[model samples]
Target: MPAHDLGPTDPAVTVPEITASVPTGPPPAWAVLQRRLFDELDGAWRTFRDRYTEPDGRLRFRGTIDDRDGADDFYEAFFNWPALYRLGGADDLLPAVKLHWEAVTRQLTELGLFHHEFERGYDWFHQGEALLMFYGICAADPADQRFRERAIRFAEQYLPQSPTGNYAPRIKAIRAPHNGSDGPRPGLGPQWDDRFGGEQSTMRPYGLPLHDVPGVAEWNDLADEELAVRMGHHMRDRLGRGDTAVNLAVTALVVNAWLYDHDPRLASWVREYVDAWRERSHAAGAMPDNVGLSGTVGEYHDGRWFGGHYGWTWPHGVHSVGAAALVGAISAGIVEGDADRLDLARRPLDQVWEQRRTGLPSDPEATRRPGWAHTLGPGDGPPVNTLPTRLGLDGWFDHQPAQVAYWTWLWWFGMRQEDRARLEALRDHSGYDWTVVHAFRDKEEAGHEPPWLAYLDGVNPDYPEQALRMALAQVAHRTALMAADEKGADGKRTHETGADDGLDLHKWQRLNPVVTEVLTQLTTGAPQTLYNGGLPLARVRYDDLDAARPGLPPDVAALVEHLDANGTTVELVNLGSSRTRRLRLLAGGFGEHLITTVHWNAAGGAYPGDSRDHHLPAGDEVARSAPVQDNTIHLTLPPGRRIRIRLDMRLNARQFAHHTSPTTSRRP
Candidate 1:
């Protein structure tokens, strides 16, 4: 309660007067680019909406994805639309987002892929992707009863002793890897298609889930029907039922629900589930990628824990496991307010680092080498550090530079000297220039953390301009891609229907031109929220007082220049030629952080030198201190005026929620 102790009701604290610094020069390049990005995103959203959806915001596809599971793909396409809306995209975006979610849920339910507006049964990897849109919807409009109901409903399906049977309270783990409203699915083999029982062709790229299926030693051998059947049976028996590490992502969904109402059960579930995995990781000497129905580390794979569905062996390896661990760890930390919960993610990261190999591989050009395809810097640079990416029966393999995402999230959450030290060490050893901005986009639509971190550390002064330019380039590229899509009767691209090749599955993300990564990092003093499933956590957020909505006001741009243990320095620039703007700055994405004081510089004689209140005159400039009420500070910006605000902040000092004034009672 001390975080909010300097309440307005307290007579001792004085309300500070704020004045903007009127500058007489051309607007900064970053400010112009920020407004341009928003404008570009506005046009891009219109094109996407008109091209893909019907009048009611439903996609124009005629049927479900045949022979393959793709409910997640449909949702992921527009998952970040609500995030754009929250970022001041357009007023129409919020309603359109809701419409798309409703239409997609209805369509998926009709396809038998959903029950109770949630995934029927699917791996958490895909489910996490699917739920991103849902989470965005909730965050954008927490006051909506529909989203509130769905949040609690969707999370309850994962609770211990729930009728869904997705979890077992006795084991303190999810009952199976593939689970949701319809409970754990019975088999891994496809139920929708008769040919091959599932499209083996779609999965052929990953080779066999289990290659040693009696007479099947190579991927080509699986072409024989009998061998393929044997392989399917092997997968069904071993991976059809069990708790895999990727299920840890479900903690975010539960935590999302808790943020709405602060339900004890939801928070309790996150703590128990993450702690259960932590105990298992400790016992196994590393985070085991799989745990069986009986809570055994390797109940189904002949006492081997690395080969389960979406686990450590077949496909993505530690990429999947590490991301899940990080999600779970962060979610637990949110509910428990314990930074130590990060150890759930840290232990595996450290273990992987321990297996790291320095210098170049003997066969540097070999595609099959351990450190083949990872981004370790320029091709002609010094040898970068490499860590194991996948753990198989053969031991550590698929080496690459330590993933920046894991280290970025860890540092953001931990915010400790050791975390900073580790992050800096990784950056130094990454073989990449931390100051260069690359236009490459990953699955999360983010891969520029190196430059962003450098900017935060003051090593990359031009990062804001470079990153924003790159973001603009990304928008332009995706716009061209959208233009190239097959046009429909309406002259817009038509949605591909009933195809299982998955070429068109990612059409949304590929063509989605809304790039918020730069804006979020530069303005809110936070990295892009974990793309798969992460609650928005930031040092600061803004609401447009004039428009009465979240995000920066129109024609206004903000940049957080520096962040430290107890404060953040930001500059708010008004780009409009006229019409003063009013904005409210909130400390934290959901009003979780506490703002102890606000320091701003005013022109000469802006305040009286004899004032006994917070405003004090210091030579030419007047320095002011403001008492923040309910985690908010109001600013009025006149045209052509730019103000630098230095906010003293207490990070994560209170319970988080969507509204500035949260009524939900938290258990802490």
Candidate 2:
């Protein structure tokens, strides 16, 4: 039986309420945050518009630089317009947005292309992606018939010619480029190969050709069924039946499923695709940087690397994997009603989070601690040069992480409240960007040229005092929300305090109390405990003992030293593996205190035997001191298992409080 089709008594079968828990009245804290966010957004828009928008209202295809003008325009327009709409409402930006839409439509019609062209250029894939954006824009704002017509036309052009056609021409052509390339070849059957002229390639679908064009009427036809069967057969045969292609194919399947809501066959395909990705991700202990329909992981053997090239990048890298996991999690929650899959989606995200927490740059920079290169020049460009590359740096101005976190917030809030709360707390405490930095460098300067550069500088200045202030603000906000909750006068629980009023006053009251207090404390300079400067801790895998232990050998004493130095926390689990190990901590003089109290599973309800209590007298080595303190902590663990631990400590007044917290409360 389908997950969503569970009987009435099933716990997972409850329907979610349609109403959102937006606060009423004037949530001063939310108002402040919103105002700040909007202010930055508005500034970003003006900067983008001034530099890219043409007099005719059509956004410029390229900035005054070397980047691909069309792609840049598409991303900026898409992110900016939809973000504005979602944050405020259509009313706030309807007019400007409409003008841009009109400009885009007119350009598409007059130029006879969905996107810009460079030489013999304008690849069909780019056009298809652009069409997808156009469709999305139309979906968000329905007033433009031309946008809809253009999207439909583009999609129709790629539909299989016959009901039982072997392959869609557009997809076939896309696979032809790598026919004999060193890269993985498409694994489609001989029929597909013969039809497209022998393109040896992996069978992963690279996100082109919209799948919802045919609608349900044609989707349920015998011809469509045959085509799906053939497609599956080709995928299994050529793609090695694995995870790489699973991500893209699954998304395609979901799009098709949405278009044919009642089709059991489509639903089955969706489940299969999701299952395959999940299985692969679990087996690898991480999702592939990218997987092909042929089941071959796309590995970069090419030596031409850039940007520290630390994690993954491009078609078969970290971003692709993260995007796949995100989409998969959301799809699984919506289609299969599987909360586990949604939780599992956090694996890849957690990988990035761990990297962030450790104050280790996800980019190759993590490899070289400091002084790797003296100057920041063009030749020293990043390996996986994507938009996030420029935005991931630590400082007052970088907004990449904030934007990424914000997008994550959208997905989490839309799907699950718990996840939303966790993400909200993470964003609030990260302190990646809280204050506005106002500095002007010549636009002609190397790093100062892009709007991203300006945005980063404006958000975070590179000064010590300013960074400290921003960091304090973040901590205050985080601490305040930790203790806040929403309740009604009648003692009824509610996400928001006020519901009937458009103002959302009650909701603000419930959420803002702690945040307000924290902010107030910070302004008065209260003490605070700063963890990795509010960044995520670096994650080291135990399998690579050397990497996990750094300077330690595979010995107990070495492990203790490593743990002590790194503020080591350990997770010991039993998976029927005979890998019991003793871990030790090195408390550097900071162990003179005891753990006063611990709230195990504070956010989530506690499990059996999960709580801990400590009452020790001062100067008692064993009782008063922890294994590690201030500088170092260590632990012993069994193999093939994991556990979470919270390490607490007291900091001086300087580290305790830096800035006033925001005037609102939140929970994570």
Candidate 3:
């Protein structure tokens, strides 16, 4: 086939660079926090490489490999590798990355694609992740067009066929393939033991490679706006319409739209899909881990099926984060046009925050409360309550790994200030650990920790020191992965995974490592009280008050400056001590700014609704002024305080000076 007809080569495409000239104006607080996260991510990548890579660039896995394909091991590594590249630039680890990539690629080819239990293999989700990893490398290095071109071609050829026709009927199996094929097939690889019942238990079908393959087509179609629209519509109809599939599918489409600089249509699809999914996912009083619009609650129903079930589940973290990130990207893409995407992005994040605040476990871990299940599988079997199995951590219980990646990505990519704050809060509450811990129990007794934390150990048995070593090793692998390839003809590699790809991997590694450690520590008699229910509070103290002067802009400044000076601020001081006073600070002026601190005197010792009471202890305060053009300010009162304040703001005459009146003023 002619080269042009083959689609853009990897080197020809340029992964969008983090422009030195980021969006200007007072940077959002999330952006600032993201820098900190990026630094940490970079450090982690360095640690990983230093520990894992041999002098010659070969990578080793320390985790267990139950199946011949080593699909679990590969996936764990794949997830971590992308994160290191996305958050931390891959300036140092080029050769090692290339070597590892070559190995993995050769392995995939030799294995005739990544067929695990059922038809599960890299050809599904992991392939997309690999493409993303390779694409990112191409973006950073841009030295190899071959990689980029190959990725694009892969997308063009595979995406359309994967989700439609014969692929459509196999959607469920594609997602969570656990049962291995009975006979040898030509294109299909070896069969692996069934673990999670394959695709039967999985929720999101598009999460696998099937969802991301369209990214290449969308990017290539960008120049032809009409074609882009048609493609976007087709994506919406096929992938976006499925509740379980829509989130990731819409996310990929939105990213394509942003890369191509399209209008609101793509973003609208994301918003609608997410909104519909959210409604369907919410139960009478609880939000399920994963649920389709048709009200089908799969294996993730209680969230604890994976492991200890403590933090986030696949649907909550993976699906929710993907949806939110896409919304955020679209919001940024349309900042010059519509504000709806911003609102959509904020909604799910707000739900996460609210759920965190309520002290409810984001996963099924809480449902198993007091008692925990350690093993991986459905909860239908007799509950085995024992030492190793009883120990639960965020990674074992929740989708903390993926959630962290999603949260960090949004922070780095510049999400709305409030949304970022909420994500930060979730991260803080996540109880993450960076080191690995050893597992003393047998494979069955080890429970869900192994597979749940696979990204960290990678086929190695859970030895405390070894787990830590593997955890750190992932950072290096990730860094190297980022440095290997270059952009092809398109700005991004046609076959590369989008930003979301890296995010999923990073989150899984970080969370799993911590979870492994936490579970280990728990087995070693770590205090159970350590699992605090509340989210981490970013502090914003209102101290050094120049007196409670009434003229102060009944705004956060009054609270902030006061906190800075005096160490605390009183939103409402005189509410009757007997009834438990409540104070309300109009947060309208606060805009997207975060509130990290509010210290008021509580007469009832922090009773609910009492200004003096700190029901939700304040940890950090992040606040942002409304866009100057919006003529608004944000207000935050102490947690339980009550004070009447206006949500509206008045713009000074000078604010409008830049705009010319369409018609001359009649008075003039």
Candidate 4:
């Protein structure tokens, strides 16, 4: 069934007035930690803003991105600020986020990296990295006309009639592996030395996209200028042009526009583009990473399905492919309101899993062994769920334990039995406890889903407090790093450094203090969005009705305790000593869920004047219910009171949008 159909649609369904019990105890440990985390986050962001940004909110990077390497890094620094604001970070944080985005865009444009306010012909992986900030801004304040215009304009770049000419409708594919506002760039930039540094440090890791370059037997041969030029020419001829799997990420861009504008053309284009990839994945057996201009898989690699830009052979193989496939599948599902669209991603994942091995080979040099595993299982113990990470002409190699990054998303989007079973099976074979929290952070600043899922399963009861503390520790660590930088507290020499000096291209991400993965998962019941360009989806989002801002009101903290296909259970607590708080809860990030019934506990008898002082009678567990067929619930949380409510919801019931609130000034 279409997910939207699960919502209650009848107008005549009667709803009753409901109130929550006036609980008379100290707030839960998680609630206290949540409030404390928010307070620390506010200070941490202010410190980061002061040290890393100029007065105008521009990054302090003295070096310019004369090429495509640093734009994503620049934008990634502040990508989660808007998300922080949406989760009730300080109000000033939103304006700063906007300023940073504007400043970064202008900075990149001046450096010749961007045109039409978007990246100019870069891989979707980086493009997706750069756009996360833009997407968060829209989610935080969707009514901003500037964001609306940019969303629509950027989405248009991938359409059949795009002014940038990114799409070749004749072949039903994007024209090149690198694409953006400048459309499909003809080839890699001519300044090869500057592009990858004089020694080509970045390119050496991937070896070469194609092995049979006329005279190159080994990567070290490319150290010569002449051989390097030949390699460049071959990469330009074979790797630069063609639709790679990474291009599937464009579906998210188009889907964002449709969410804002409800344009039929935008929706149609997403379905068309995604469906084209869907057809190709099936025909090729395991989704081919590259398709030639003529629309044939492996047309450039002598009929091999794996070797393409950011495909199975080079860089991250199934990892990148799986991320892009998830985006395409989720976008298609959002457009159609059907979970079945997830098959676009599911099939490819299954195909990769079919090639799974028991463990790594005993011989050290037998394959391109990435590394020994430690996170999922003991490093020295027997390997568990060793799946291929990359594949080439020799065969599948680069093996490691399975990653739950995209599977977590698949389960969140579909909420189907099969996805649940698959996740459980993967967990059973993981050879590690699911509830253990790791301190390591990825580019997305996530990867704690196993523990989070355990919490939701009622096993890891302490995850909320543990994760919040983890977030606090991370912020403190990053803040200390920022203060200790050689550029000093103010980052005075940041702009003076050149990229050639090994100026830490990912410095921003490493030092960014804003951490939202724990808050997002616990409060919103959604996974950390795919950092490389996926929508910030949620089961519920909030607004501070009392403060007229886009987060929990002062002294208010929320926790979504349970989530499933049919309903959600959330606890709202007002920790203030006196002032009552009003909160507006929207079902789904874009008001896409229909909250059919709100069930809560209220005082059984009438309140004696002030409800906050009323001690509930013994065993007075009076439950109340209200039939709510819309997407919002206006909550009045009194001081010293906490309420836990189960919201019977139909996921993806309404047209997605940046909806305006009936009370707050938040606009549609």
Best by TM-score: 4
If candidate 1 were superposed on the true structure by all CA atoms, what would the RMSD be?
5.5
Q: Write the per-residue lDDT of candidate 3 for residues 1-668, one digit (tens) a residue.
A: 00111111123322211101111123323223323333445465454444443444333332333333444333334332422332223334444456666665544434444432122332222222233344334432333455544433332221223332111222321122111122211121222111111232222221211112243332333335454444344333322222232223323323232222223444444344444434433442333233322344433233321210111332233333344334433333222222333443443444444433223222343323212222222233332211111112232222212233334334322324655565445534543322233322211112223232322223323333343343344334545444432333455531222232341222323222112222221111111110101000111111111221111212121111111111222222121223221112211111122222332221322223356764454332223122222211122233223332112222111111101101111110
Ranking by TM-score: 4, 1, 2, 3
Structural similarity to truth (TM-score) of each candidate: 0.89, 0.36, 0.35, 0.91
- Against the reference, the lDDT scores of all candidates come to 0.75, 0.29, 0.29, 0.79
Q: Give the runs in model 4 whose Cα sits over 4 Å from its true position.
A: 1-18, 191-198, 214-217, 224-226, 358-382, 486-501, 605-619, 661-668
As a TM-score, model 4 comes out at 0.91
For model 4, what is the error of residue 328's alpha carbon versus the real structure, in angstroms, after optimal superposition?
A: 0.8
| lDDT digits (tens) for residues 24-97 of candidate 2 | 11222322342333334444444334434566667444212222123323322333253233223223344566
| True-structure lDDT of candidate 3 | 0.29
Clashes of 1: 0
lDDT of 1 by residue, 239-285 (tens): 77778899999998998888876899898888888999999988888
Select the stronger candidate by TM-score from 1 and 4: 4
Q: Which stretches of candidate 1 lie over 4 Å from their true place?
A: 1-17, 22-24, 191-207, 359-382, 486-503, 605-620, 627-630, 660-668
Top-scoring candidate (lDDT): 4
